[model samples]
Target: MNTTSRPGSPAGLRDANRRRVLDAVRGAGAPTQAEIAGVTGLAPATVSNIVRDLAAAGRVEAGDEVRGGRRVRAVRLVRRAGVVAGIDVGHRHVRVALADVADPAGAVDHAAPPERVEVRADLPDDHGVADGLDTASRLLDEVLARTGARRAALRGAVVGLPAPLDLATGAVGASGVLPGWVGVPVAGRVAEHLGVPSWVDNDATLGTLAEQRWGALRGVDDGLFLKLSDGVGAGLVLGGRLYRGPDGTAGEIGHVAVAPGDRFAAVCRCGHRGCLETLVSTRTVTAMLEPLLGAPLTIADVVARAHDGSSGSAPARRVLADTGHHVGVALAGLCTVLTPRRIVVGGELAQAGPLLLAPLHAALEAAAVPGTVRTAEVVTADLAEHAPVLGALALALERCALAP
Candidate 1:
């Protein structure tokens, strides 16, 4: 990589060189001044100047070290110079975390419990959007205060929503399931309330970010992160980047038309029939099993029963296996196109483990292209249900560190 800045005005070139130096330091971990100069391909004097500037900015720290029988300066990222906030707003819950830039792993120091909230009805009479936004703002405030992170201390904030967000406007698009969120500038509203820069993206995208940084897919350049819960979505990390398409709806595999006009077709929130979500979502599977059990059952209850074999009801296992099969079918198509090295399953439904993975692996083997299926490894999300929240913190850290 070319570390030299383009020929430009003095200030612009200087800033570019500074960013390059900071990026090299972050990517290489702790290194001596000579090591940084060698990796960045910059002169030792230039590296020294940049390191001095970064130290003054509180972005980097330096210490004296013995190198070649001489005292040499070593530099590393400052882990606690500032903090960033990550907020995840889902259809049924909200999560927030606070973290710093140098420790991009996640906000292990501070986390707020998942807050349950009601979704606004599609009808005009519903005050769902207003109430939900208010509740989210209040929870954000509490989380930040609890973490001892003040507004000024926040370098930036990142929010992840369950719906498809417009990348250009930060608003929910027409195809989104959250009717109240349509036309709502979520990032702007949250930023205004929190008095910080806020960016919003899909929950799956954030999940992919978190997984890439610290979860199952760490160090893998190309992978697929499937989130199976109330709905199915994917985060495609290709060439070490999150590939959100022009419309910001690239990984919406849930609404894909799978079984058109079938008598068993279930209605989808997107007003479609026989979509993948209809057959595979936790909502659908849990609803089917709840009636059979003659009692209300949550997805957790179903997993617990399947684990203990207490519900020897074949229907419970079948529901989980069937849902896994549907997911594998969808992933087979994805694998053919993307050929990712790994596929990580996350969200509420993934807790079933082999009850889901067994059927999913079998379906993938049966449906995917021969070579691709053999190479792809399907595994459970290491973070489990907390993937998105931790991912949001990672997103915030990246934004803050890369900010101009």
Candidate 2:
């Protein structure tokens, strides 16, 4: 057995084949040798040999499984060694998730189905900077404990703030949805609390990443992700990469002033009047429906009511439709400028479904250039509320040095 490592040598060929097989198993979740062979475009014998070697080395696990009514040896990446986490900080709440780096499931590309990563949610986000970081740290710690992984097992993390991030400083930009977080080095702060390296980006940007990599926007090189939660913001993907612009505010569409009259304008979180956010945000929707509901209302409450057919539900539906129209009006300008191939709508208010989408689509078509509107697809996000967190997880896996 010559141990030469040159490309033509037996050892080199086996090493390359081993990598191909391992990648297939990791991407396929529980692919059999035959399945791995098909995915990796390798011979069945070669796949079997590589799987056997990897299993013996504790890099992968194999078990008997049934596929298409046939029994086969199912192979999957081992998870005992390490994991990564993604944290999403919204205007209303926080969400966290953990993923095994070796078997990142669907975090990478279309090669494999994504794994069912667990997420802990509903951690409040109304607190000041220090308190918000503390809340995020506690939630992350709780998720790690629930998964039974040691703190040291956390390879890295990605924090998604519902604001524009100044990439140069890792701080929230001037128009951050959470004012208290302005100028705070959010990624560094979260990293300090978690005792691990961390990275950060806008929540909408992460949502776009998740959709492009795993959800509805897959394969779309030029796309837009519109997040309508506490506020209205956007994430852009141009030429297959996220476009953050010179100041990382490229997609901060929420702060763009829309209304003309000061009397008609409502002050936004960023201190601007008539911002797209002031008209279409969850808070704005709730405020508009309060008079009809005769009580304080939440976005969820409005969405739920809008779905009902009762006369009382009429007001809720009307308000949501109006908000959608405003959002569409702003997005029309964006579509004209960016000319994305698709626009995926996500965030809390998007749960209103057709009640919101229909009006938004109508307004966009009315405002945008006919050619642009026809070319741009406006669709609901497939990942729903979990997109940002999953995007964060993908970010961690891509940036971290997790041993697999």
Candidate 3:
């Protein structure tokens, strides 16, 4: 005897068909049946049936529309059921975003420009963590209220930190970059403060995700994101996914030894001598400039001075060029092994633009093999400093799916 299933009788087939139709509708706003068929690669009959079932279950809305002189039913996803939050914690600032969970792509725009508040990264006292967390939570609440969303409407939140995280214990790695937060469970604290589930990742990794999703790195499977701020860090995108490695330290390019035996080598926060960060980080450049400038100066001041056309900017430009050379030397090794298709530089130093990137390119060409150096194109990040926070929103929206 032949066992044949009736129409829509096999549960698995129906579920798969439903998912395909749902995904197509979500991807294409208000698509006709023929359009949905083309997008999902399904027959017209299958598309019609799936749309009918989805409409009945209140998962989608179908309306009559005329397309090319013919009548067609347009299908669209129902409005998102809940909201999600994205939190980015930098060395000296915190940024947060509130967005709709159902439409992750649109979450980055909920706050338009996002909200940021500066706090000391050193955290010299015991109360630093609590105070910082409270400030971030308050900013989150302000943005939620501005967006006409209640705190209870939040489904989840994603937090980005400037340091690598131990995947197993949810703690910052032993880099000593974040002295006050080495052992603190950042995700847990954010979750408790906001009364929503929270997740954490390195800020550079999140920046890579944001760029791949919404900025210059779109469609690039092999790409590298370098964030040169108070400290230097990197994020890698390989095979269309973020590579965290076994211990979530795959992108710690800052710690790679570059000027190990230099006479003026400075100790890195990680307690390493002459690491790449020691030579290329904004902090290092600032320290190098303080004596010549006759006073302590911020990284922004240095970049501004370098852009100045006067004689005073000569020292600043020289230092930045030298820093770029060292950074390119470290990146050359990475390019030899990974051979990424693109390199996006963000953070404070990136604002130096050609002043920094030009020297970096020259150094990379001088160091790496010609073939590998030619394959990767280095450019400034399109999303700029907001990349990490936008990436956090994308993470929350993708990971926190609510029931229909």
**Candidate closest to the true structure, highest lDDT:** 2
Instruction: Order the candidate numbers by lDDT, best to worst.
Output: 2, 3, 1
lDDT of 1 by residue, 200-251 (tens): 9998888877787778888778998989887678898899777898889888
**Model 3, span 271-351: residue lDDT tens:** 878888878877778889888875678777888888877665999999989988888899998898889999999888888
Query: Weakest 10 consecutive residues, lDDT, candidate 2?
Result: 105-114
TM-score of each: 0.81, 0.82, 0.82
Candidate that would win on TM-score: 2
Each candidate's lDDT (Cα)? Answer: 0.76, 0.79, 0.77
Worst 10 residues of 1 by lDDT: 113-122
* Regions of model 3 farther than 4 Å from truth: 1-28, 32-35, 43-59, 62-74, 105-128, 261-264, 290-300, 402-404
lDDT of 1: 0.76
Q: At residue 93, give the lDDT of candidate 2.
A: 77
The local distance difference test score of model 2 is 0.79
